[model samples]
Target: MIRSLRGRLFLGLTAIIILTGATGGLLVYRWAFREAAELQDSVLIQLASLAQNGSFSSGRPLLGVEEDTDVWLIELGATPRGPADDRQLFGLKDGLQVVMRKGQPIRLLLRTRPDGSRFAVAQPTAVRDDTAREMAFRTLLPISALIPCLMLVTAIVVAHSLRPMVRLAGNLDARRADDLTPLPQAGTPSELHPFIHSINGLLVRVGLLVDQQRRFVADAAHELRTPITALSLQAENLGSVDLPEEARGRVAALKQGMQRTKHLLEQLLALARYEAAPAERGEMPLIALDSAVKQVVADLLPQALDRGIDLGFQLVEPHMVRGEPVMLATMVRNLLDNALRLTPRAGRIDIGIYRQDEAAILQIEDTGPGIASPDLERIFEPFFRGSSPEGDGSGLGLSIVKRVVEGLAGEIALENITGSDRSGLRVTVRLPLAADRPNEVSGAA
Candidate 1:
């Protein structure tokens, strides 16, 4: 029932080690216990033989054996000797036998001498059994100690063996949504090859599907451009003929709608094109980031003047970044377009381009009503206009800018600037700087 492979493997291996250790220990204990008992019996028989051969004086009990052994020598003449319990042992024949002494059982080895005299060497049954049990228990010490060491080794090995799978999962989790690179199979276990192959196959299919979707969107946008252009021209042609004021207003409105539709189609095509192309660092060249920003700002200056908005650079520095110039221009254009749409007439917009910590930094601050807190997080979603939407925006400006920034391996952040008397939004972008740069800081204006 264990769901984790690590848990199952560890549990099963531990159980096997414990079972094997216990079974082996039990068998060894039994064998050792029997051997010890037989050896003790043989020692008693040898002592009785030595006593009968005059190795010890008659009528004297031997005391040379270890104190804990509790062995004793008894000499019984032609009749019984000692107490009644001791006399009962003399009734037994030669060789090893069990008899009761002082109501406690004892092992006695009886032997007859050449002179027809008889003697016995005896050991207490309890003491002899305790010695055998101690020897048998000692036989299990090695296996008992080895089991824990083996269990420790097993746990370490299991974790080490599964490390690759953990790393592979982390790699997958950390990948970008559009990333469809196949998983690497090198250095992985042979048993995992089939699983890796399946994942690679899935990635290939997913990449193909994404490519098809991008192509469809791009093709559709391209197809719609012609009709939208024709409609705009037809509306424009109506302006040449004299007409009533009401008719003129309707034609103007129709022209505006056609223009908005055309803009939307163009944005869709741009987004699809950027998504379809793979962003490779080697394919990108080092571009002057500050120059790109200046060009975008210059292009929008006329629009700003028409709306009575002050648009100019606050700071400009020679910063270089790796990306296609057209893509960079597109990103800057989208950001400026969004800012221009949101800022009211007579508002001021500040732009900054500089180098910070080996990165090219682009920051734009606008004097306009800041984005609502509820919509701030989702502002970059495609076609997601916040509550109290601003002028005729397709809601795709910020989304397009975000896609372009990410495609260039840059980061973008949006936060509302707060103060007691002022409110606006600050947009900050940081892109990895190129390897070379001009050594000079342009003064802030």
Candidate 2:
């Protein structure tokens, strides 16, 4: 009924130890009791032999043969001498017998002398039983003491034996969601080999399934792009044809829809490609962090001008980070696009890139309505727009940005910039610096 393996093992072991100890203790006690009784009878026999040999006079009783042994020598002559109990004992043949004397049970050893006289060595039955019981209990002292020590050793051994399982659980819990590495079989108990092997096989199958899904998404997106482009071209061609005002409006809306669809397909393709890419640091090339940020901002400059939003770098420093250049560029573009779409006309967006703590840090701050607190946790989820989403965004921007950042061994954090007269979202990214970077310090521009 125990739910935990440790509890069950401990309880089972403890029960076995207790049962074994009890059984062994009972056997030893019984054997020691019998031996003590036999030995006491032999002592009485030896005392009776000594009395028959005339070693001592029998007119008086002998006492204290040894301390704590209440054996005594009684002279009962050939016939009964004193009490009726003694008379009854003298009438019996020579040897050991149990009888009542003075209304108390006694163990009497009877013997006849060559002179036609008789004497007996008698001991109280209670005293004999008490001595035997004490000796028998003494025999169990070792086993009783050994039981607890055995239980302690059992507990220690159980914990030690189950430690590997505990460590395995912790390792699995700490692993990344996408990590498909097999559990190591080394140092594990042979008994658990089959279980671990099955788990590794499951991981391999799951990884394959995930890779296949990614490829399907990428392939589907690639196949859809050509037709979507052709449709967009057809819509663009309709722009030159002379059409009524109502038809013109319809054509314009169609063109906008096509543009949105194309953007969605592109985002999907990027997401699938990034997810499918293996996260291998050695395969990634070093890229200038500032240069990438500057290029993305310049590309969006026209859109910023059209909206009168001041999109420029507040701080720039020469720093190198390890990542695929295209993926890095995609990440920057998505972040900036999201900011541009949210910020109103005349809004300001500032970008900062610098080296901090052996990492390349990129910070983007925008003068737009900050994201709601409840939406922050779910913002990075694919196709998850906030409650008050703006523009025709595909909602994959932040998701792609998150994937790229994680792929490059970096961390991204988003927070609302709070202070007096300020309400905007601030994005901070920290990526591990590439090796072989110059030691020269570069001032922020």
Candidate 3:
């Protein structure tokens, strides 16, 4: 029932350790029991020898043997003429014997003295068996103590062996969605090599599929741009021809529709361009982020003026980030364009560029309604305008911004700025700072 591999392996090994220990302990106990019994019998034989050689009377104190057990020294006389117990002892020959006296069992060692007098060394049978069992139990101490240490060692080895797999999973979880890099094989166990190989194969196939999709989108957008432009020109030409008021209105609408279509195609092409990483990424020089935002603002200034919307930088600081010029420019343009579309007349758009830690931060805040609560989670999806889409917005602006930011190995986050009197959306971007070269790059000022 255990779901974790670690639990299963540890338990299986633990069960085997316990089972083997039990079996070995049982065998050891039986052997020790037999050895202990034989050893006690030899003690009786040695005691009998001392009695016959030194000669002792029945009244003598025990020969330094156990005082608690029922041990006895009995003289059967030379003729076996005494009590029934003495008669039974005389009936046996020399050496050791187990016999009954007074209906109780005893271990007896009988030997003949040089003077022809015979005697027996006797101890209770139950007492000798108890001593043997206690000695046997002592033999199992080492094995009982060893089982827990083995289980501890097993747990440590299992965790250490599986650490690499845990680290690999964590690395995959933290990567960007478009990342298709192969898993590393160095330092991994040979047992896991086949699994890693399968995953790397899958990544290669996925990368190829994605590249084909991007190429298809780029080609389709290129093929459509020419016809859309011709249609726009034709509509413009028809506008100047003398026509009724109703026809003029229809012609104007036609031109507007054509313009929206043209913008969509341009946005699609830009997305395709930045969706995959460019080869020039490795050779790109450090460029000034403040200057890139400034250029995009200049290009959009005329449009802002037409709408009476105030657009300007609140703070500009020199910060260098590594990326191509067009990529940065496109990124800034789409962000500003989205802001301009949502901001009403007399509203304000603020841009800031500065350094934070090892990253360059580009932030834009606008005086427009913040995004809907339900849409924030899914706002970056392609063509996912919120519940109330406005103007000629293609909804690809944010999606393109996301792709460009990821391609540059940067992070972007959009949050709603809420206050009692005013509310807006704040877009924050953090790009890794390249080696600073402020003097090498020209300023936009």
Clash numbers, per candidate: 0, 0, 0
User: What CA RMSD would you report for each candidate?
Assistant: 4.5, 4.6, 3.8
Comparing 1 with 3 on lDDT, the higher-scoring candidate is: 3
Candidate 1 segments whose C-alpha is farther than 4 A from its true place? 42-50, 53-64, 97-99, 234-259, 304-310, 342-348, 367-392, 415-424, 437-445
CA lDDT, every model vs. true structure: 0.86, 0.87, 0.87
Q: Per-residue lDDT of 1-445 in model 3, one digit per residue for the tens?
A: 8999999999999999999999999999999999998998888887777787655567354658777655677777788787887897898998788999878898888888878888888887888888888999899998899999999999999999999898888988988878899999998888889999999999999999999999998999999999999999999999779999999999999999999999999999988877755745557767888888888899899999999999998899988888877878888999999999988899999999888999999999998997998999889999999998888988899988988888788899999989998888899999998887756564333
Sorted by lDDT, highest first, which candidate order results?
A: 2, 3, 1
The window of 10 residues in a row where model 1 has the poorest summed lDDT is 436-445
lDDT, candidate 1, 1-445, per-residue tens: 7999999999999999999999999999999999999999988977876786667654345657787888888777667877786587668888888888778898888887888777888888999999999999998888899999999999999999999999889999988778899999998998889999999999999999988988998999999999999999899999999999999999989988998899999899888878877579656777888878888888899999999999999999987787877778888988888888888899989999988897889999998898999999899999998988977778888898888788788899999989997778899999998765344322111
User: Is candidate 2 or 3 superior in lDDT?
Assistant: 2
Candidate 2 local lDDT, 384-418, one digit each (tens): 99989888899899999998898888999999988
Ordered by TM-score, highest first, the candidates read 3, 1, 2
- Cα deviation of 352, candidate 2, in Å: 4.7
